[model samples]
Target: MLDAMIDDDHTAVRASTQDGTYPRPQLLRSAWTDLCGTWSFAYDDADEGIASGWSSAGVSERDIVVPFPPESSASGVGDTGMHRVVWYSRDLTTADLAGAGHAAGRRLLLNFGAVDYRCDVWVDGQLAGSHEGGHTPFALDITGSAREGARIVVRAEDDPLDISQPRGKQDWREHPHAIWYHRTTGIWQPVWLESVPAVHITALRWTADPRAGIVTADIELSVRPTTGTEATISLSFDGRELAAVSAVATDRETTVVIPIAELRNGQSYEELLWSPENPRLLDAEVRVGDDVVYSYLGIRTAHVARGRFWLNDRPYYVRSVLNQGYWPESHLAAPSAEALRDEAELIRSLGFNATRVHQKFEDPRFLLAADQLGLLVWGEAPGTYTFTPTAIERTTREWLEVVRRDMSHPSIVTWVPLNESWGVQHIAADPRMQHFARSLVSLTKALDPTRPVVSNDGWEQVDTDVVAIHDYEWRPDVVRQRYATDADIRRLIDSVGPAGRALILSGDVSEAPVMLTEFGGISFDTSAADGAWGYSSATSPDDFAERFEGLMAAVHASEALAGFCYTQLADTLQETNGLVTDERTPKIPVDRIRAAIVGHHAN
Candidate 1:
């Protein structure tokens, strides 16, 4: 929100919707203000600004765009250099709080989409609220603090070298290298104010079933559901009510599944098949007493059975791409919600039905776009390379936050707690790491038993529903030579033979649905640079196309592989291996890439 120009090294273009529109599109209200544009910012190198009364004394004379962290070029302060602490202060004028139904008399909820690492908020020099975890959203009720003109100050701190914190794709160096990009230091998401009733709905979750035509919506009321209050939910399509139900209770949480089957029988809705080919969504509205929320649910049934992935109770192929969720300008943040929507639709247009969202708890708006676009997603956490008590604590707390926020989305079919052998690397020999891996799986299951949980993806997959592997065998025959039969796929490849020693690091068994979860990182860019390149670099575009086709053909011919996820959707930072370039331009012909992936030639 830095005025007409944001400080960055790019084209110096402007972004749209820099404001108080609701970030949580899944649960939306019309009354809110966008406080995203500009604010007073200063770098706190000594990290002593808090004790120095920066909150009351006011920030430095520099203007910065809120939510676009200082490290990002789009933030208008492209200082990739580490700043242990940064301060942001905004003057909350009466005009900024003039959203409908949220004027003077209402309790103003100050919402932040995200703030990296640890953050403390102050309203007029008084402690308002604070939140831990970089990816999760938080809100504070600022009723009395909403004067005509008040100073709202936020201080955030992040240390990438501190392995305990979940930094995700944000780099740890002056310049991004390899898989990591520039570190997102402070506020990297939207900040806004909303007016809500004293007793309102706090959270809403939807558990949908496409096969049975039933949607169970769970409502968490801000206060205890009083006897005089009622919670009503309606499922509608094109404004025609398909099913309606209401509940009167006294509990804080109430759950009820509304059957939207045909009037004759309580079975599936044949016309409402939700797939990448035909994305269909059921519009849902919920009202708790006087508080109303507009939301929608995707009713696609996703599960795993018989060593196969099932969609809507039928065997389905997971044509997925590995998406790192980084952009050239915003780093971890998307330029706009429209950019997220366009990215989802673009991936779908390229013929990918699913995506393995790599190493990031992606923006909820992107997931909502996937829910609408019918793209299956494998939700994965950003990998942590070190194992310690601090790491485990942070992982547990933040992982649950991730699950609780996204568990209701029907598009998320699988939850990957860890990637490869990242944090728990010595799992094969380290008992503690093995136990922790198993515990992560158990913790994920305890929260939401609906989706399959992959504890440690790639090699050391201990206690997971999917036996996933990350093998980059360049040749087609070499790939076939490795995984040829069900025995080869199911064999406990650990603590035994050469193949076992090579492939398996810790898992006790591999008797699960086999998915070549990661492979085909063929880099087509021969540009001379110092970027972090891919596994196998391609010489020419024609050679890259041929190699891709041959490798995909090998994967398709293998009956043992339940599914495969291409290395990436687009190039990022130092890595230049993708079906499309970093700018989303197809490296190979889009149709040709699709043909290779689907095992068919384009017409």
Candidate 2:
């Protein structure tokens, strides 16, 4: 039989006003508990009904850890290829749910931080629920299904290369090389249980309009009891009470708008705003009868007008890095909260104001850290290289998941659905792809019009708020020919006229921001090939440094370029062209890169 691994000791929940608190619903802790660390795991080829009878098949010979999927080393089941389905079974006692103020009879909710592709939950051998999207969190209310000491079994099946789902950066073909890695299957994040009242707030979404000096809040309830109830939504900015509005909550959504001027001590104009440099957050409290939900919101506004991106109605340059959020040990999941925080801090230390989460949707801890640290985030859906209708639906579903799960984070400034036309073939001509991109953009705008949405990051620019491009002039000759002479660079900029391309680069050049979404990828190796120095690899450290300096010089000199993100933050497997190594260790010391970008090294 598979050896059962014990769960981690629950950390004491402490409330802090400064940092260390997740920017989620206040009742999140008491309502949900993290089920991270070991559980009995097994794999089988039998039908789904046989999940409960793992012992009968003699499949208990080896154990796989829970939360961390079998493919990840962190899960203690390293590199299980895509040939088999993985099963995770664990026994949960009532004692496991005991803690400060937690009582019995509350609904026992099993929350999966994330399970790839598809997953099903079985309680006491009864199917409880199932989820489709792999990158978003899902929960099963295993209340009555659990006996006194019932065994809860979770079965997850992921066909990483199935070409029917949204598999971002995952190449399932044998040994993945170049821009792809091993497929992450089953539970790859924390799996835990939480107890909540039958009638409780399901989720909370906050949208801030810094220009209007108002914040609109939508509080959703899980269960709708007969007869509507009057709920109070309170807003506080920097400890000062903002507004307390009463709204009726039925079986549907409840919204309350609070003006910034009414909640602040002074006029709305006097209130502080949230930005990349200084992210100021306001505390919030929601109450339905005695049940209270707590959360925070940052006062910031993001928009694209003319041809520029604005933060709080001012032109702001979004210098950023492409963060893939992959680790050697954890794969998709970060090893710990500190690991997430370290990445944010490292990115900030590099003098960049933002980070574009390249392909994958990161864990909530990463988003929490970004919120607290005041970093701007461009969240993107995981892309599939190939195109299909099933893939399109999967992408749309995952995109919805991203917006719903990450809507409240103030750090998230933009939503990118399609990147580099990975799955979008013939974007302009293909009605389906165009419709999908336009729908996603509209959905993003309707959901949170406070921020801009990029329908497609590069190539065929659609009706997005911004015209973004990813130009990797990897070859030195291309770089020299484009920018070596001032006249050539000027001509290039002029060709992209003021209203370049219709917001096709044709938007107001002065107002609408033109972003070189991806550029400056110079790779360096101690023992490098002779010709690899130019386009793909740098011969020596000096060559890499020189190329980086030159790229930044041209970027700083260009007035048309509102912002640019260095090709990547770190190298991934064979993609050695990154500012930092795969392990997140800086390849070209942080100070040196910062000096070239932000210090005296100029155009």
Candidate 3:
């Protein structure tokens, strides 16, 4: 474990020997320890670990990486089978606890970035806490349970074949097929520990309004502070101080509003607004007593108006790529913090201003990179296959958690709750499914009204601000004919979509902003995969380059389209239709692909 600090600029100022990236990028503290690396692991095939008191003892039979699931090769236990019950244990000494920082008045908290399905945490043979939902993060306070020779243990249970669960791309089949891959059963993200004051901020959210020239922060504390306890929030840009505001806390929650005088006093607000071209971020420092948390926010606003996607009150074209966020060795977990940063840079290098994080809630570190690199994100969740009471309960619970966990990121401009009608397959005809989709949109908007909410991203749209469609038609002429004019786009919206389903379930959205959200999945690589397939296939690199350029030309020439998202950024398992290989090697020249994507290629 290594300790790090957040500099005055709200960037991580790490020790020279620090190897891991900070887990929580938005909220930063000076004293924290990375609890990643090796941990004693075991498989409870017979479900006997809990009954046998495994949580109170060590499972030293096998060693597994802390954040990577046992299913991934990076975990050092490349077993992709159905291990519903998995146990992890690690030992920590008093000296190890002291490594976090001064410990006299501070309480120790254990945090997990994410764990699949459900898990329970135990510290020093006592149940510290438990959490559900695989893709969202949670923390547990172990102040009273920590001592010398502290033993930390975890128990995770996930049913791989449960179609009712939001499994995402994790295939339930014996082998990878179609678009599904292997399962990620247990702890597949970073775990860490930090020392915090008895009364500390538990959550922080920043909202930026460039038009209003103000930024608001909502702070949640561990407990209500005493009288006269004040919270100070300071904002700065490029190391120059902007505004500092203070508030007296009367409850566990408080709000601070800092109005930027420069934006209102004739200063060029364009220089401060966040966009793909200029990802201007305002650094902030929040202090309450001895608790200080550093954070940052991008001043921007995104919405849909007059049949166009608008950023900072101006129409902005969304050139996006569908990102699965999977790696060959690490599965859902990124190989390293540097890898997450590189992934964002890779997407930007392909001339995409945005990325639709397909079917998974990505790492916060990746979102941080997007914020810094000026990439817009469409936050989506894994959809369950079946539509049942259990499925609805699980999906709703988890989707809300995902939105709440990620809505603060300025890079994220949209919230996609359902995609291609996975859980609500009969949404077009079933009123219940339609209602479910609509309710998700309403709930998401209730939590966050700053961004648009796509009720169903691909098709079968129940209620969506963006008219998103998925068309794999490879012919450039036909693609041109489909969206050549506003009338053609309206007719297509009222008709059956490319997936052979109604584009809209009940709404009259002929005037909403239209986007080709999924298209051009042209498979060009077959060297690594035996039965690799895509929506369309090309024989060679030149063929691929031509096909890609043609499809993109039609999309870029559309008079009715507000944006487009190519499917996808890279290949995954049997789905080899990617601009780049699974390892992120561009099949065609990077410049050639970028030219086509940006509409600068010489057709």
Candidate 4:
């Protein structure tokens, strides 16, 4: 384990590195020794000028855990209710970087899993770099500025009022009652240091086209020198080497394409397609001189055509639940990789083929698990209340980051920009908002021509490819009345039509390919016994079972209905109306839900 320094009062940072290793575990590689662990933390109120200084008094204030935000109880700082600016400082020595045969390089990369809103980083009192956006990961190269043993200080400011930045579900208020929750400030995810050469691979974009039987690898180098550098890319499926190409890296961009057929040696030539049922992945290795980077990707294609969503050209049903990716212990962060995998497996066991990651962007590990486990995903930005020009620009930037990072995963099929008119007031009526929504959809479509883009889900019907709605009326009879007769269903569908709107519903529906995007308000034993539908009351176990049966019966009986996702897989904080408990423990037993969803036994 790597030795770390925190405030004198706090214990040494618990190094998550496995057996003093470096380079750390990426998405596909699952191991216990991966860099995931405890770090020292201190909160600073911007009103007070403690974050800018590095005095002994600033270091002795208090300590919390790293990766996990202060609001979460798991971080040992249970809900301070402080949404103001805060700073975190820690120390790492050269000895910490040296492990086994690995030596500290000239360039030291300080990596942050994620930070909320905006952040500025410093090493040895010198400014390292700064980054914006709350959900995505960013890093800074602190090679020249640091000493043999250096102090790393990070200051982060988050004004949830700043609607320009993408903040998924973080409300500025002290307490969050409805669909929103408390703001998660500074260092919510993991922070670590790595040694990398000055000239190394900064980023790589991997795209696999199974239909064309070709995989295109785009490599981005850190520096473009006068003399070009060559990268040797080795492509392999399973364990056998397919193709090896050494390509010259230009200042702009470099691409290398390899045919799948060339790798198949007398084997049956079947196109490798990634889907909820079958998620096949290929291993890839990129070597720049002696430094090597290993990664994996799945080959799949997704599109919407003729009012049907297709994967690999086959009509695929996206039976999905709205996953906000929040935990009672970690707030917006997942406690562990195991926790992420558990959610994916639970969703699959419940007969859900996909998940709508509502309003929030998820960690890379979550998407990696989904891709490996064969779960389709609908990704979206966090909901906001403002849509100013500045807001649109910032949102567009963050949305692009979301797309760039998650594009390689085959599980992600739909790119959803707006949700339920949270940002667009009167989304249905405001022509400007509607036009902006249409433009966003067009932008997403232009970015990734393969996937379907849903512009404004469940509210304004813009020029998007899919027409989605979120109707959560309580009464079952009323729900049935809206979609019972063809004329009624047609009228409901016609309400949002110029034409070509693939009607997708959140509640009960009687139309073909109708999605129950939201339903099932059954709570667990811990929920309060109120008549309200949210986290307040726990329906009687018998009543809960009855309602589940009734909903399944209604959905299966309607031939027009394609698929439905339960309200949620697990209960989020204050949202007790979930199929599973807050801790991801089953509320009504998994076998029962599986029987209802997969068996299709109508009551």
Against the reference, the lDDT scores of all candidates come to 0.77, 0.69, 0.86, 0.65
CA shift at 324, candidate 1, in angstroms? Answer: 0.8
lDDT score, candidate 1, position 395: 83
TM-score for every candidate vs. truth? 0.92, 0.88, 0.96, 0.86
RMSD of each: 6.0, 5.6, 2.6, 6.8
> How close to the true structure is residue 410 of candidate 2, measured as C-alpha lDDT?
82
Top candidate when judged by lDDT against the true structure = 3
- Residues 220-257, candidate 2, lDDT per residue (tens digit)? 77777447677787776545566778877776577788
> Candidate 4, residue 461: CA error in Å?
2.6
Query: What is candidate 4's local distance difference test score?
Result: 0.65
TM-score: which is higher, 2 or 4? 2
| Clashing residue pairs for model 3 | none
Residue-by-residue lDDT tens digits, candidate 1, 191-224: 8887887667778888876555578888887778
Residue-level error in angstroms, candidate 2, position 164: 2.4
Q: Which stretches of candidate 1 lie over 4 Å from their true place?
A: 1-21, 210-213, 263-268, 491-511, 600-603
TM-score attained by model 4: 0.86
Model 3, residue 322: distance off in Å is 0.5
